[model samples]
Target: MKTSIATVCLSGTLEEKLKASAAAGFDGVEIFEPDFVASSLSPELVASTARDLGLTLDLYQPFRDFEGVGQEKLRQNLRRAAAKFDLMNRLGISTILLCSNVGTAVSADDALAVDQLGRLGDLAESYGVRVAYEALAWGRYVNDYEHAAAIVRAVDHPAIGHCLDSFHILSRGWDPAAIETIPADKIFFVQMADAPGLTMDLLSWSRHHRVFPGEGGFDLADFMGHLLRAGYDGPMSLEIFNDTFRRTDPFRTAVDAMRSLEWLQELACQALERDGREGSRMELSPLPTMVAPVGFNFVEIRADDHRLDQVRTTLHQLGFTDAGNHHSKPVELWSQGGARVIINRGDSTAGSPAVAALGFDVLDPELAAERAGRLLAPPVPRDRGAGDEQLLGVRAPDSSEIFFGRVGRGGVPAWVSEFGGSTEVTTDPLVTRVDHVNLAQSWEYFDAAVLFCTSVLALDPQPSLDVAAPTGLVRSQVMSTADGIVRLVLNLSPTGSADTAQHVAFASTDAIGAARRARERGLAFLPIGENYYEDLDSRFDLKPEFLEEIRELQLMYDRDERGEFLHFYTESLGSVFFEIVERRGGYRGYGATNAPVRLAAQHSRRPIVAAP
Candidate 1:
């Protein structure tokens, strides 16, 4: 599948944008209207440069509020569109994006809109250019793919086709299954993006907050699966509009965009295979296949002190039963329902408690390891013994060992079973498979970790950033295998000293529900301020009750054109915390706005040390 990006996604001079897109490995680009209007380069020059750089001009967008206008106004809009099409022809492009009439044309009747679109399609055909009809989430009458496709089908012109935008389709809550019904030939273009779900004014969010796929919470796999199943073999393009993404270094942003597409491609392939569709082998696999494909399998906590029993007791009260002690390892498993919590004694010599390692079950341990190895480095040999002990280990970029195995042999410990004494029979059921792993690494080892992940584990590297803080700038690098299952985030301390490894983020279906359940079980969490709610109310036009609930839960949030996201920081366990995310629609992203707030919260909770 050929991949492309919209020129508007990158922020810079036209030359820089073109250069960055080419460098990032895009086959083509959808030129945003602003980029084209602002460009100093002539259409012919731009076309020549794109050819020299081996990039195609996929589409020019977006002519908005063009249809259903008064005759004179419509004529003028048509003339303008014609000029744009001429320029596109000069630039050797063949497609133009026509956003459904929003504000001004929303009230126009469907028949009028169809007639106007048919005229535009006829005009486009005159120039040998195709018109891609897109449904804007905030569009007037046409806001969903089904509605937009109806218009396209009603026009019944060869020049008119539908553009499948994952963001718009998902953000509007349109069923992804609809793609299966549309004729593949009519799928002229495809746009993909991910954003964290948020409660904000959709217009404002669309203008300033979009995330790359995999960074947000959209089931792109399902969307892509539907597209592929329909035999829609069109150029896959990315058109993201995010304030943070625009402000970030253009080059790095381009690289990350490419990484996201690669991740999505892998995900699409896997989903297709699972659904019994024919596809090629995966480029990389980041997950182990030992357990069921959902929920937290186990939580690993590494501590420097010998508080395994204390920690175990805490887990016990939360309804967890001890699995069994490993004869050769210094680890013990505790379980509740399908969730397993592994307590690692790796740092027992030190007084601080930290998370050491995490394990996930996979369908095939060796294949998963091999796939992971291709993205980073070869897997390291792990010891295996008789009776349910079969497992393989791989080193992530952050130097943490990820163990993949089937169910262990031994039964639950008698003490734990007896202590928990209940009519409930314990059964070893596979929980949620491993989603991704985050790591906190020291500055000195940052480069080494990156190398390890790339050369040893064979994961793709994302652009690194140095976040400025009161103490100093914290540099971090994130690497993920092509399959999108394994993720390692390596963070370096600003002080240039060895830093403790801490913090983790787990994926979940419902954060609000999970938070409530965790609270009921006595898990402590930091409280969000009412001020955030006030800001949320003013920033987003959401209902008062929903805003109240979010603020009451201390959930941090932000939205983009794609979708919304929610976040919360845990109490200080050093500088570490967990992010529980629940994606609505197609949003995918960590709540970036909450980062500073969370950091400040952590700073406030830091223990005051006395001078010796």
Candidate 2:
């Protein structure tokens, strides 16, 4: 599929946006009128520069408020459109996006609107430009795609056609099936955007909250499926208007936009294949295929000298034994049950005891890296000494490293051999493998993180949830592999926090028993309020003794149609926390229902300082 992005979606000068778009492998750009008006270059120079960068000026956009007005006002609107057509001719742009009258539309007469649009089409035809008319979600008279389509049909002019924007249609709750009836030839342009479900004014949401496809709540693949089924073969252009994207680096945002389109096209093709539909003009790119992880290889913790001993002691309290030391580096290996932890001292971590890296046991490390490269994930380099096995890792948006390696017999590498002593230790361990890793992220980087996991790591994104915090609502999502081997919980941190803290949850056969044992070992659990148990009793039909046991253990419980989830947390070890969890009868959820209580407890413990 040919990919294009709106110039308004990026930050920087027009020249920078064009260059970044070209470098990100986009074929064309939709020139927002404001970008051109503010540009230093002339229209001809802008066109020539785009040509030099191998980018096409796909569409000259957003000639707004043209139809459904008085006769004198209609004449004035035609003149305004004529001026833009002259500009489009100078810029070598063949199409103009005319959003339906969001302002200055006095008459709601359909015949008048049609007559004015037909006259404007005649004017556009004089300049060899086509008009892609779109309906604004909050337009004065035309607020729906079906209504706009009817106006286009009534006009029946060759130079005027429909511009289908996913946001405008999907946000208004319009069914896309009606699109199949609109002739493909009449569909002039297709613009795609995804957004989180927010209850707000439509214009405000459209302007400041649009996100890249697959990063939000919209079912874009289904929308694309309907577009493809209508035989609309055109550039799959992006028209995003996000506050964060407008301030981020232009080049980085351009790359992210390109990745979103590529991922969307691939998903659309998969949908088509599933439906046995053929004759699609789009072709999926060769991205890295999804590989199911056998399990977590290890979790690396980075610490400085001051916090090193505290980290070690905390691990001991939680039943981890120091197994061995790395032969060449200042690192120690610790183990409990089948889970491994690497404590790398002296690494320049953002905070004390931060999760530095996650190692996954895949089928082939080299092949996985190759796949990641195809998906445009940049590789991060590591310093390896002599006889050290090479590892393949991709740097995440939050600067965390994710490494992949082979695990089966004869396929495993000897990187662990560099450790001096035998890593094996025998003990009655309480926790087994890693259940999940919760990565806290800033709101600006949340979309990038979701796209990274879904596109590069081949994980499935679950519906986003809002967790109540002491400060505000925290947006949370869970992405996991199909076979339940790898699970990542991404939380958008509460605003104005110093830093986003990370947590690791380990699985156990009996979470209550593990919590009791750890408490007996002198581990200070994050205390829960008695009111929580009272509320829990009201929510669930549990016996009095069971509720009392939960209250004593300070454990959280959640149940759904599938099964039950029980978990308990430890007090903060610097910026990191730990959780022991048990899943009963295929429960596939984190204890989200208990997040408010946990957040309130944590907030109550925040150390306060006297003002100077």
Candidate 3:
């Protein structure tokens, strides 16, 4: 299937959009009327530029509110349609998007709509062009796609066809199975968009919250499957109205848009295969085989060379022993059971230690790298010296590096030898492995990070939660594997302040004992006020001994129908901190109920950030 995107989905001039689309490997573009009208180039120059860039002008959109009017208004609309048809010829585009009437509808009669659309189609045929009628979700009448399809069938003109949009159909809770009822020849074009499950008005939701597929709550795979079964093989173009995309870098937005389509096609292809069908006439290419990571092999922290004492001391107090230092770089590796953390003192331009990279255990490193490359995620830059292992890596949406670690027969990573780690530990370590990592993200990269995690790392996103802060709401999204070996928490702060710290949580069989050991080492814990403990005791009616111990250690506790969770946070050293968590009896949450309290504690100690 061909891939296309509307010019309005990106930022910058029309020419820049065209170039970026081509760079991102899009086959065509829909010339959004406003973008074209706002450009200084004439129709001829625009057509020539697209031709030189090897792009087809797929559609000209969107002529609105042309039906359900009185005679004088109908005449005026036909004249307007004629002028647009002429402009389409000059631009070498055959299809024009004619959205259903919203504000200009005077009657609820389908007969009026059919007659007006037939006349418009007759004029379109005379000019050798086509009209792709779309059903806006909030249109006054003909909002239902099936209703618009019935109108198109009644019109029965050669130049008239219905444009199927996934957003409008799914958002309205319409039955997409009705799509197959319409003949393949009557479907002109297709548009794809995904949005969160919002409860606002349809028009406002469509305008402000639309996101690329896989980044939101829509079941796009099922929608695409129904379309494939309907036998309408056309361009899968993106028509997004997102506030962030419009303000972002056009080139980055275009690449992210392209990735969504690719991921969607793969999803639909898998759907077809599951139904025991080889595939449709549409040539949907399957992506590289997705293999979720087994577990975290290592995590790298970058800090200033002179500011490493606190980080080292904290790790030691948490029961991590110094494994070794990198042979070629100023990086040290520390280990506790299966968990490994790297302290890099080479680059600290940010003035604080932050998560710089992550390594995941994969069955086939090269194959995983190939899959990421196909999704347009660039490989993590490497600076290897002689006799070093061939390490493969890629960059995440927030610029963190991801390395694919290959293990030997004993499940030990082969690259650990490059850092001079000993063959075995001299003593037993306290924590077992990394449970999860909470990564703070800028608002611009939150959605992109979610999609990137889903497509590249093969992580499934769990439900999102809103953690209230004094400043505003902090949106938290967790992405992890089915068995919960690997978890990533992406936090969208209200201010997206760079000073917001990220934390690495380690798993321990006895979090209470681990907290006691760290406290014995004179480690400072993030204090939980007495008020929080008193409220916790009242809420859960916890045992007196357990309550007193937790209160003494500043450990947060949460219980549910399934199980209980015990966790504690360390005092922050710049933009980094540590956490030890114990999940008893399959507790799967991150203690979100206590997040507000934790947030308040951290905020009070943070430096006051003045208004810019």
Candidate 4:
């Protein structure tokens, strides 16, 4: 599959964008008009530079407001087209994208649009150029793919064809099945973008909120499947217009765009295979088989040498016992029932205690790492001691390591032997295994991280949610294995805040008993407002004693039709926190409704420091 991206999707000069795209393994680039207009280099120089970097000038984009006008306006538009065609000739580009007119279109009549497009086609043919007419979601007349394709067909010009954009087609709730009926030769170009579900105007959303495929709500696999079934064998280009991507590092954004394309192609291939059309004309790169993890094996925390004692105190207060010390390396293993926490005193100069790595138990560690590597996620290299078991780990976008291990293999079970073995058990503790892990990321890296989790680790991402935060709104998404294990709650921290603390939630059979034990041991619990308890009393018909117990323990509660949830958080120890949770029956959520209360309370206790 050929991949291309628009220059407007990145941040930098036109030259920089071209270099980044080539470096990220894209085959071509669509020159968005504004990028060329702002560049100091001539069109010839841009073309030559792209040639030197092994990139094709795929298409010249965005000749807007070209249809639906009187003869005088139509004549002027043709002249404008002539000028752009002359530029495209200089740049060695053939196809040009003409978006449906959203403004200054006098009529929505199909005959007028056909006539205007035919005139544009005549002008384009003079310069050996092809016109790919696209429907803008908010276009005045031809706002749908069917409408645009009908106009293209009516024009009957050899140089004019339909341009299909996934965002424009899918965002309007139009059925994509009709795409299979359009002849592939008439489908000039395909542009793709994914986006979070938003209840906003189409134009604003299209221009500001677009994301890469696999990071949003669109069923792009199905979308691409129909396009392939239509036999459109052109470059699948990216045309994202996101505010975040525009401000991020151009090289990183380019890499992420390439990754999204790879992931999308794999999904499309899988879809085709499921439909028993494995021998289709569409060719895709080979992908490793996906492996779903069973559950979290352990969580590793890295504490600054100075704060090691404080971290130890917090763990001990929560009823964890020192299970074993690492044979080599300055790491200690703390255990409470089935849950294990590895505290690594790595860098002494580090400012705070933070989550360093997560360990997951999968069926095949080697296979999982192989799949991740194929998806462009290389494993982190670690120097091993003579007896240390090798763990396959990949670094997340935020620089945290995610290690994979399997049972009855040279993985987690073998590594456990380095610690004094199962015979070293002492006293029983309150907390059980890890219920879920909460990772906080900046807005810039959020989508990339989501794609990594889904494509590399084979986790299924749930719908995203926007929760009220103390500073602003926070976006939260959960990714989990198919078997309901290895849950990861990713929090997109609001920009300009130091509230991106990492957390681990441990499951407890009796939340009240666990709370009392921690309290007696002097662990500082984040205070809850009395108003919360009052509201809980109003919401649920809990017994008076139960309400009083919740008020005394400062716990948070949420209930649904399936079950009830009770949880409480620890005061922030630098940039790390902890949660104790008790899930009654089949509660599948993370108590997102109580997030605002927790945020307000955390803000009240800690001084505000903006995130870097």
**Each model's TM-score?**
0.56, 0.91, 0.97, 0.95
Name the better of 1 and 2 by lDDT: 2
lDDT of each: 0.67, 0.85, 0.90, 0.87
Question: lDDT value for candidate 2?
Answer: 0.85
Q: Residue 528's C-alpha lDDT in candidate 3?
A: 87
Residue ranges of candidate 2 with Cα displaced over 4 Å? 107-109, 346-351, 384-390, 410-418, 423-428, 498-500, 534-553, 558-563
Residue range 345-430, candidate 2, lDDT tens digits? 85555457788898888877888788767666779898788887777998877778999866845433366667776645556667
The residue-level lDDT of candidate 1 at 224 comes to: 80
Local error of candidate 2 at residue 120 (angstroms): 1.7
RMSD per model, one decimal: 13.3, 2.8, 1.7, 2.4
lDDT tens digits, residue span 1-612, model 4: 988999999999999999999988899999999999999999999999999999999999899998998888888888888999999999999999999998889997899889888888888998999999998889998888998888888999999998899999999988887888788888889999999889999989999989999888898988888888888888999999999999999998998898899899888888787655532566788577866877787899887888878888888888888877778877888888767899898678767888999988878888888877766675799778989888899888777998987764533367877776235554555687899998999888899999989988889998788888878888888999876667898998788876557899999888888899899999999999999999999999999999999899998999999899999999988878999999999887888889989988888888756999
Residue 417's lDDT in candidate 1: 28
How accurate locally is residue 235 in candidate 1, as Cα lDDT from 0 to 100? 83
Q: For model 1, how big is the CA root-mean-square deviation?
A: 13.3
Off by over 4 Å in 4: 276-279, 408-412, 420-423, 426-429, 608-612
lDDT, candidate 1, 1-612, per-residue tens: 677898878879778899999987788888887887788998889988988999988988887888777788788888988998888889888998888877566345778888888898889999999988898888877788998888788889999998888888888778988888888789899899876566786666666666777665567888888888877777888888876566556776776677667667667876787785643222333332222212223557766555555565555433456766665566666665445566667554745555655565444557656555443333667554433345567665345676655433242222232122234545542122233455677533344465445433446667665554445566666776554555666777665433323565555556676566556766557666667678778888887787777776677778877788765545545434455556666664455556555655555556667999
